[model samples]
Target chain A: MLSKAVQKYCVDTLCIFAVFLFTTNVLAHGGATIENDRCVFRSQGYSIHFTAYQPSFSRTKELCRVVNSLSETIIVLDFVDEALRKLPVDLILKKQKDDQLYADYMLVDERIYPAGTMQLPMKKIEQGSYRLYVNIQELAHQHEVAENVHQIAGFFEFTVTDGAKEKDQSFLARSTWLFYLLALGIFIYLMALKYRS
Target chain B: MLNANVIKKLVLSFVLLTISTVLYAHGERNQEPFLRMKTLHWYDVEWSVKNEGTLKVNEEMTMKGRVHFFSRWPQVISKPDTVFLSVGTPGPVFIRKFSYLNEVPMIQSTGVETGKSYDFEVILKARLPGRHHVHPMFNVESAGGLVGPGIWVNIEGNADDFVYGVETRTGQTIENLGTYATANVYKWHAIWAAIAVLWLLWWIRRPLLIQRYLLVKDGQWSTLITLTDKKLAATMIIGIIGLLIYANGVTKEEYRYTIPLQGGKAEVDAVLNPDEGKVYVKNKKAEYYLPGRSVIIDAEITNNHNLPIQLGEFTSANLRFINHHVPAAVAALDEDYPDELVADSTLVVDDLRPIMPGETRRLHIDATDAAWEVERLSSLLNDPDSSYGALLFFYDSNGKRFISEIYGQILPTFVD
Candidate 1:
């Protein structure tokens, strides 16, 4: 049996450990974060923000993952860096499949887009994951990238849920998950410590 | 003695603090609220602790700021697709020496994310004279300008003694920036003025106006332009013609490689909605202010392309009434002047889900966002007729884009 102080100390340590893990996980992915109620995408260290919506299903819900919806969906990308003005960014989405690693079934594939706010919406979606491929080569480099965008590219993986996983995803929820996890661990540790004592 | 030494130390520290505090550059006050609360939210701002903010005309300084694009994308606003940064004092007060987006010298559009804050460092060379308000401004290509806090800048004097130059590929250093063009304009204006004066003197030497009046008054009056006068006029005309020809020849020879201006409509595939390429936006109807904070629409859409497309955004009058089923933040409208450059969101539907090729669907969509209210679009009081317009954009997984326009009149209702 342990003293109350020891129990509290152990609880605190476990809480701290849980916090560290959760925060590290959240910060693991650079370039994308929800800050102050906004969905921002960071590329080349510059912060680019975007919006995603499905008019038929949601009006206030902004999406980071593709959700299997009963209706059409839309996503908007806003550029904040002038350096991207002349660069031609190519965006393509493929259905993640087992037969092929590079899925050819493109749902949204645009080549050589001018810089600005761009929207990618789909007429329909399935219940699964999606591979969103973004290739950044200056529009001047279009001739070189014409055959393939892999010359200079980075991609983001997004999941398509059945509306359950993304029901209440918000900036606050995503950013504060670590803290919540910490609290949960602390509570569990405290309960265990109390029972042990 | 100890007390005195302590007081002295305190005094010195206070003086140093004052200088450091007031020396940094400041931006406009009104712009701060809008820049922070609206368009682009700034955070984690870091500036040089060294710049106490006084700078010489020829001297350079640097400052940095961060923009945290949040996810509260409102409808009826443009996305910040093309953004610019500059130091201004009512006008461009400092010539940008260098600008780094996220610490890298980014000269073209840079990729960024909403809900993330990116740092920006700007180096400026003070060029203008006098004490002016200095601030940093971010401009969206089609959106309004957003300005930060303005600081008082006292530029002592012009860098009159300073010279600027550029090294040419041919190994020549050209220093004259303005005098070359200015001197030519002055020379042409002086020549034209001199010619006008000479003509005036020649006309005054004879009562030209009176002679013309007399000729009109009396048919028998000798013709004002006699044979000698005609001969003189011909000689002057010939001289002018000869001078013009000589000037044209000299210019043609001097600028032999000049090319005529060529401008016209460019040829490219028109961005059309894949679903609506062959199908028009038919039976379109709208109900705004649903639940007092949203707009709902029902429309018939058909995809003509072999590929499927999804509705991405609906934009009009600089506002993006996007479908927010996914993560989205409408680029804020720059609240500054020059509404044309207000950074309105264009019809780039890069993320509308794919509608199967040759599929026609009747859809009901709800455009919900408090931005609709914050932008005051739903409660516009200026227009009694309450007419408005919007454009619907569609995109496929392949990234092909399409657009359609809509016009409607509103029936204003109070949320109170």
Candidate 2:
């Protein structure tokens, strides 16, 4: 037979676990999606350009056709130095029509540009690492409240190594091994503690 | 021996006293309407005090009450509407070690709707020892708003002298706030903790061991030592309770510095009144080199208030346009207005000129649009639908200041 103290301990443990699980569930989300496919990030001396394409598209014409197939999109650009939060700069570009240029209201960059290839100067970029995130949401062009679907276009990581050496550039660098090692260490430590306790 | 009835009465009285004192303090603070209205109002504030490891410690934080939008009156919103979580530390002191907004790293900025409730959380590391008032700060659609000014936090130690270290796999070490340091706070805490546990174990078990050794041999000895055992248990319970309370207070003082953030909604009303004189903002030209040209605004000020007042300062959001007649320097666009386009509002042409009663004076303002070159991305004309905001500050014969905010399209007429 279970003693009163043992039963009480079990009940209390269950209560605490239930509270934790409920809290975690309340904080979950579907995901973060991009609103526009076109965007830009400008620092002091250079500008970063971003473009999104369907994996199925192999040629520039196919990419252009895919771009035309979409109705609405949102692009968010985030800028950061080595260790600080900074504002994301928006870019505006124009797209070319059939022998005529028209302002595509729905397909413009943050600066409201038309659908077409645009070039930005390096002078607009500040000296740091930057991320340009483009989220493409295509709503059914016919309906007012069409179901919107999206895809995450991968980001490009680059450094503004103007007059500076690559080794000296202290921006976003690929060092996943470090994070992986830390995770592994934590896993082992937790396992050891679990068994010991 | 204390009977169950006596024990029950003592516990009940202690609970009543604690509850009543807490309620009375809250009641006294809620009496003043201005303090109730203007003071920092906090809601859904969560604070967690943790050890060196990311272990769960104490996670209890309360928002004293709900917040109300200050200066929600129409016709004046110098700063665009924004809500932010503010804590009283120099700035991002903990480096945010690890944080979440609705479980995301993003800072919470959902506009406060009146009477709507929201919860906030902050994970604070063991930093400086001091008691500080941290409040949730919000930037409303206009001039100034701070719900609670400060939280009386009693901190006993300095943060600069504090340190925590994390041992990494590659023999590398990471310090709290990502700063590199050799001091390890964890080692010190571990040593102190070992001592505390040992002391508690000795006191609790020492009496039981003696009773087992001597009293087990005779029934008389066991009966004689019953009082001693009861006294030992009581003393241990009291000591543990005292330690728990002391530890909680020290955790708040030494490690946990809460940012008492304020939350609430504001209502805005804008209408044209005949009696209220209209302020015209006109410029000969609108476009200029973001760094080169200046756009001058001329304002005709008329004091409607019976008493004379002086215009103290003109501030919008994070931009202080005019302060005490002296104009602030033109800051970098990204640094000043992170969310919106920055308009040059430094009144360099004329500084701190006063307007008397029943008199209208022309105020000239030269806003230098800094030089910014746009690389046209295959476009013939620039987009005209860009969002631009304008604001004006006026002071009457009295020290009271009135503000007028304008929102319209800024048509940049290009001159080649």
Candidate 3:
């Protein structure tokens, strides 16, 4: 039989551990984060504002990193750095098939765009884990200083799912387990109170 | 005496703390790329300080540029229906004296449309003594700040020497805006803080949380508040009302000449009509040679002007490819212009003969430079559109210039 103090300690520890787990789950991600109320793709010294839309499905709704429908999607890449507008950039979209990546769509815009905006439209993309790669060609003078200078490149991963499945696995679905843990903690705390009285 | 382990740990901690301080610097780079890229495109930006990029405290500098609202505004962010033109600095390192959009004062938020360009000028006075990076920025109503290219500004002199004086409409001279009313602000804050602390202590002097919870659980929570507590709460509220009335009367008597902060938007028309000179260019075919890092453009050029003209420069996406053979073209490049954006190798023309007036001739021009690959323009050959556009400048012997737009499909050639 356990003493009242030990029981109370176990319950307290359980509640703290549950909160820690919930916080970590909310903060964990591969890439892409919310900044100033908008989704941004960030890498070392480079950033591209990423926004997607499915005009055929949801005309006005804007998407960040995830698309519910497998319909036609238009992705806009905004160059955050002025220098990026002077470099040639290539966008390649690939999906995983049997542990190997295959190209789904590609756009090679190898010109300096004074306007600093690029739009990529992909039609009827399949549902899977897709990786979008941004390849920025290094300047010619950069190579003169070093014989071998790697090209600057970065990528972000996004997922495509059916609308129903996305809604089914929404916040309530994920938080069900958390709610159970919270209820258990409260019950234990109440029993401790009853015993003290 | 401290042991070796304690001393070593202390040194290691000091080093770590020094390194951590660097992480808080350069927050401009931390902004997400989308806000910077999709919201506004700044071009033809010129930052000029009064004295070669160095200024004494209270000295002024100018930042002038054109801002283009990107045509394809991101759908995720709200439309830029309202925006304020402002300068981005590390806080009040510099005080903005005046800001104008298309020659109209931009004192408040105004609506802006997409696919339009506006000229802007911001005059700033140095306030602090340090090297700082400043950028022209626009704060959209829903979206955050969209910053432009940053330039380093050197401010020399002691920060204490800076002062901003203003003469009000009442002919009263205020010495410094920074220190004005600061004492009064502190006094009011201190008075409020003392009262708040007293109220907190009065409540916290009794049992809190667990005891209160027990009383609530036992259905005796109503008995927790007594007549004395109600009377004390009423007295505190009455005291706060009295203090507010007294402060208002004292402020009205002390500062009678104060004016409300200015509010209202200025109207400025942003319309431009560029002159397209009497030189016509027909892009016959364009090819990019992978090995040579060159783009060869074969075009039919027709000069409508009376004087014989030569191809002098080709500018695309703000990169100037100058023809060295044309002395006038080389002279046009300003000394302050960025060297990297100017190609080292000039535009190579197959024929040196000038095109006569009313004569149309097909000539091959090679824009060969390592910059083509460096700038990633060579990738356009593989673009889905496979099209390119550029401005061609023609010059006569007298240094007279004519401009024509050239655009056509471009093909890539892997072989030399």
Candidate that would win on TM-score:
3
| Model 2 interface Cα RMSD in Å | 18.5
lDDT of candidate 3 at residue A193, scale 0 to 100? 65
Candidate 1 iRMSD in angstroms: 13.8
lDDT of 1 by residue, B1-416 (tens): 57633554565556444433221122222122222333554432334423224666767666676554433333334665556665555565666767776666644444344334456777776777666655555665565565543445566566574444555565666674434356657876886688778767766788766667878799846766578767867887887788778878977885565656633321212112234344346536655542234455567778876666677666433334444332322222223322212223233333345567787777665554433432334433233434444455665556555655444443432121
* Predicted candidate 3 versus true structure: per-residue lDDT over B1-416, tens digit per residue: 99644564575556444433222224434443334334566655777852236888999888988776765576667897878999888889999989989888888777777756789999999999898878888888777776765667889999999999888788988899889889999999999999999989988999999999999999999978988889999999999999999999999999886777867655666636243447888989988754455678999998877888999988664456888899988877666555545666678889979899888999898886544533445455544556666667789878987766676777765333
Best by lDDT: 3
Candidate 2 global Cα RMSD: 22.7
Error in Å for residue B336 of model 3: 2.3
Cα misplacement distance, residue B15 of candidate 3 (Å):
22
- What is the per-candidate TM-score for chain B? 0.41, 0.31, 0.67
RMSD of each candidate relative to the true structure: 28.6, 22.7, 14.3
- The alpha-carbon deviation from the true structure for residue B411 of candidate 1, after best TM-score superposition, in angstroms, is 6.7
Candidate 2: residue A3 Cα off by (Å)? 13
- True-contact fraction for model 2? 0.00
Instruction: For each candidate, give its TM-score against the true structure.
Output: 0.32, 0.26, 0.52
Quote the positional error of residue A51 for candidate 2 in Å: 14
